[model samples]
Target: MAEKVRVGVLISGRGSNFVALEEWNRRGDRAYEIALVASNDPDARGLMAAKIFGLRIWAKSHKGMERAAFDMLMDAELRRHNVQVLALAGYMRLLSPEFIRAWEGRILNIHPSLLPAYKGLDTHRRAIEAGESFAGCSVHVVTEELDDGPVLAQAKLRIRPNETPEILAQRVLKEEHRIYPEALDTFCRTLRGEAQPTISSDLKK
Candidate 1:
């Protein structure tokens, strides 16, 4: 059996996507192990969810800490766990450029919208308002620029007329759950020097 790749996940909310990754790993393929789950918000539900999976959890309040200081703490924790890859699943905080440089290609993020468009908050709302025909999610490398990295995979859905942002968000979230794990698995495989699977950027509704 091959040694599992160690992974550290960062989350800010319910961590539905984090749960997806965890569940995927539990199926006995043993390609990767979720070594740690860390959150900036002590109250984040994801921390509790991580506990349910019997994974180690770390929480710190980022309210008053300087950006670099906070990120340094996170970096240290991840390193302590010997994490080879980091995944940002709705982690909310914008990482500093210094942190990005340190991790380089090792960090991955799943954004709620197609990249190079709706790069920031209110992504679903902005896409709806822009009269887009499609709205979806993108899993990509984490770079200094937010949501501007090379897309490894995407799950797209056609936008229905009269669709509210809330409704669209709920629908797109399902796709987010589906593709994030796939992208992360592919990423881990690449790190392990295994045969890389053909990953598609387009996932039809």
Candidate 2:
């Protein structure tokens, strides 16, 4: 039998996507396991949610520790948990190059834009402000540069007229939850060896 893929989830917000992945795991179909959940913020609601689901949790505030040291701590926690896959649901900090290299293709992040497009914060606002015809999310490998890694899968949503940034954001978030787990599923089952990431557009233009 193949070893179950152990996963570590990193989040900075409510962790809706993380919750979705956990829920998906409980459905008894996936071969992945959420071994740990780590947050940079101690106050994240996801931390509480993770506890309710019986996941190990860790937090390290970024205010005082140097970047490298903080990453070392986070990396150590992931190692301790035997995390084979790292997923960033809403992690807000920029990871260092060393950390990225250490995990390499093992780490994944879900960004709220089509990527190579709106690559940073306020992605929803930027997409709406730019009057984009379509906007959605991308789950990609984490690299040193922000949102510049190779994308694994993407789901898109049409931008409607008179759509507020908040509304567009909500729509994008829905897609985020839908695709993150699906992307992981693909990675584990079909694309584990290929590693040839591509643009999957069942939901977008």
Best by TM-score: 1
Candidate 1 lDDT over 148-204, as tens digits, reads: 878888888899989999999999998888888878888888778885745466656
Q: Scored by Cα lDDT, where does model 2 land?
A: 0.86
Error of 1 at 149 (Å): 1.2
> Could you tally the backbone clashes for each prediction?
0, 0
| Per-residue C-alpha lDDT of model 2 across residues 85-108, encoded as one tens digit per residue | 899988888888899999988888
**Worst window of 10 by summed lDDT in candidate 1:** 195-204
TM-score of each: 0.95, 0.93
Candidate 2 wrongly placed segments (more than 4 Å): 190-198
